[model samples]
Target: MDMAQRETWTSRVGFIFAAVGSAVGLGNIWSFPFQTASNGGAAFLVVYLLAVFLIGFPTMLIEFVIGRRSKQNAVSAFSELGYGNWTFAGVIGVFASFITLSFYSVVGGWVLNYIVGSVTGGYLGDASTFFGSVSSGTVAVAAHAVFMAITIAIVAGGVADGIERATKFMIPAILVLLAGLAVWGSTLSGASAGYAYYLSPDFGVIATNFTSIVPSAMGQAFFTLSLGFGVMVAYASYLGRDDSLPGDSAIIVVLNTIVALLAGFAVFPILAATDALTGSTGAGTAFVALAGAFGQLPAGRIIGFVFFVVLLFAALSSSISLLEAPASYVVDSYDTERWKVAVGVGVVAFLLGIVPAYGYVGLFNDFVFNILLPIAVLFIALFAGWIYGGEAVDELGRGTSLGRGAMTAWLWWVRVVVPIVVAYTLWLGVTNFYAGLVNGAYF
Candidate 1:
């Protein structure tokens, strides 16, 4: 916990790779493709790009400022940055990271299950039923616990030995597998339909629902990038030098965006070919459709194994980052034992995984995605926007010209637009929660 030395990145490459690893999770591959298709095709992409540029960048700057300025984890970083009252923002951040990884472990568990099944050639038989059982009930819970355990083990190792070392391999492996899948999927007969559904923007469809799409775009923008969580601030706080935050930020964004685009190449073709493109394309879409494709295709089991392995890497990378936010918080704040915080969080995450393993699965997903996530992010934006003020902007543009020119305007946008959108999303999350529960609305 003696981060007083100011953590330096093992390399600039390591820094970019770690950030990209954080950004390119199930959010990009599992959620983005279907969410885009379900929302309004290319229109969703357009809105998403705008969100990334207008809000995501500034918010990232904000987190970087807080992290670098305090040179501490979320808790200490927030309290150290400004007035005592503003420290609440730090608390909210640590809590958000905690909540995020809780259910995420459940999904991570599902990925692990698929990985095992792929090795066993389970997908060679019945894809639908196999993926179905994996999605719900007690089996899913067990898998989640296992995933959390793996995540905790990595986080316990601390920065250099744990998170950095793991990402070095996982990120490259993930990229390789995803590339292979995208290439294979392109050879399918229905790949064109999938590509059309993915890339062809329908303005008419978008025009009909601009209001809803704007908010969806904004939320996806922030959440997908993992900005405003104090997670980035936590990571940046470890830095010893203020290299090119602008160039670094842009590299992370492009890597994440390309991965998301490649995900469509990997997912949509299989879905269209298998004829599983149905319903609202919920969180379960990737789990169902891809598993189905793996079952039916020749050499299906091996492909399934590759998919799940890639997924496991994605989940682990992200889950590690999520745990790091909170564990770092505890380590920095009380000078508590780092291993104690890591073990403590892992145990809690293990228990929390149960919520999504049973009847409350949908509720667990909605609660985190809808409630805690947006609220935590909202406070993060507010802190960076009003409390940390211009310092956040200066943190980004410290040693570069692009940083200097863009930092002021970016700060202005974060101060003006970002918090307002976060607040609105928080409200929407509440409404969605009630509707999903009382009204029995399909989430």
Candidate 2:
């Protein structure tokens, strides 16, 4: 854990791939499509895209600036920058990462289940029933543990050897498989309706449902990009002074967005073709509706296998980043060996994940995504814009081609825009959660 011995990304491309790997995961493939479907399709898509640029991008730059400036884990990074009081923000980030991964690993387990089910046709007949059976029983618990174990093994390998190497391979494989699925999906009989739903916004829906739509859109935007939780901060800590934060951030955002769009193209078309679009509204959309679509396709067994494999890769790529956020905190703080800390974190996460594996996924997901995530982001925005302020701009500008004007603009956005927008969204989320509680709906 010596400063000089700390592992840096071997190359810029390697670092970008790893960052994109973290960004483009179940958040995109699983959550994005479902959130879009439930939140007014293209209306949600439009708001989500705006949130990505307006909020997510600026907040991501804040994380990178903090990480690269401190060269420490998220929690210690503030203290390293002589702002120890703001370490509370970093603590929220660490907690978010830990809690996010607990339920996240459970979904990774679902992907694993489908990968095998694809081959055995286990989910072919009644996709909903199959999902119910596998989603919450002892089988789900075992799969969650297995997924966490894989994540721990990769993270134990250290940054360059484990995360960078795995992502270098996994990201390309995910893109290729997803692209192929999109192409095939385009040929489905009712694909145009899917395309319309995904791409054509209904302004009336947005006007009528603005309150509900914005919160979900903003949350999805942050979730898909791995924002709010310091995953990016931990990743950026490994960056060298010569790496361009602006360039890297842009590339990561663009690539991640493209992959998300491709997933929509791949998913919605299939659902439309199979008349299963109505079912694409919950956590089980991919496992149930999409799996059902696959069951009805030509050569479905092979296609289904490939699709699940892609999902598995996406899940691992992001899950490692999530695990690494807290694992890096422990490694940086306690000087524990990376492998030992990785195992410890993995074990605890697996144990804590049992609730979600037992079918409390919606509760956990609501708490983490809607509530915890926005609060974390709000803290980050305040620190970057207020506490860190000028120093953050200097840090962002250090290794990048961004001029003073651009950096200033970014700083102001973080200071004014991000805080206001995130606060409003946080209010919405809290209100919704309270309403759900009063109505006994979340259970």
Candidate 3:
């Protein structure tokens, strides 16, 4: 599609919904709570919130400026703006999106199986065994393919008709269902204990593990907001100059944080009430502990069904954006039809996903989260802050009413602060990955 003929969001609200959908996914509901609980509880939460505002928000604004200014896909955005070699940063984003979706779709498949298992009571007998059975092997591969197909179909429909329309319904449904779940969870017998564990900070843990905590918190902020990858850039590409990047970015961050907190409210209480809080982190939290907790409830099956349905929606919403990063790149670079590109990308992702589906999720997860994502985001910070500094500020000021002073402040923050912090985080991530390898952690 030509630049003028390129599809744009039908409305700002639609764009916001789509962008929020991209952000609020398994990262919020699945990863955020578990990461927070595992990494010093409220101590981690404090760092995560700071990272969101200081690092994530600024980087997001830079991405929006880049996309809206160039009116192109993530990869083409840089070159379109006359930054020839810096397009490499966009390529990293596209690659990160592709790799992320490979493992992510496998997890999405797990959600699909849970949705079915909830209705059939397949997991009631032994949640661990059921998750194990569905998480790998032929069943897992089949489910992964099914989830990828759904994502491809949505992307093939194009932005306005497909992505925006789907998110408008899905995002609201996720929020409403999550709120209801949180309310019900608050009534559980051990609700106070759960809240205490989640909300009360352990300052000593942070003091002792500050290095590890900061990186983990930074990664969670990036993951939950769908930053680091080109999803935000590609989504922003569909935006018009009339949309206020700062306003929309604040809304996205705030809503995403709310969803993450609500997920904690909904999950921790149930785990505490059922005494299933032990080993309730990572994938085990969702499939094993929570599934088993549901089995012990009065209307276990019904609640389980609703919870997994919400999870499925969250998974699909994020997955489509991941696929779109690469799809947009291919479409913009090669001028291919969207449907064909979607199918092609889906096939490759399914094939790449099989290794994880066949029981290697930890490997893929470590690579993407600890290695690829930090590198991608680091490059984005450098590009936005240094390479395209003044131009980025100019682009950011286009739609909003911010004065030159505010814009200049943002430019300096992105240029100096973001890159330095991101670089340090990237170094920590690399070292952690190597340490994990030395300790045989991923095996």
Q: lDDT (CA) for every model shown? A: 0.75, 0.90, 0.88
Best by lDDT: 2
Instruction: Report per-prediction Cα RMSD to one decimal.
Output: 2.2, 1.0, 1.2
206-235: candidate 2 lDDT, tens digit per residue:
999988888888888888899878899999
Instruction: Report the lDDT of model 2 for residue 337.
Output: 95
Clash list (residue pairs), candidate 1: none
**Alpha carbon lDDT at 216, candidate 2:** 88
Looking at model 2, the pairs that clash are none
List the candidates' TM-scores in order.
0.93, 0.98, 0.98
lDDT of 1 by residue, 154-185 (tens): 88887877888899899888888899999999
Can you give the lDDT of residue 200 in candidate 2? 95
Arrange candidates, best lDDT first.
2, 3, 1
Instruction: Check candidate 3 and list the clashing pairs.
Output: none
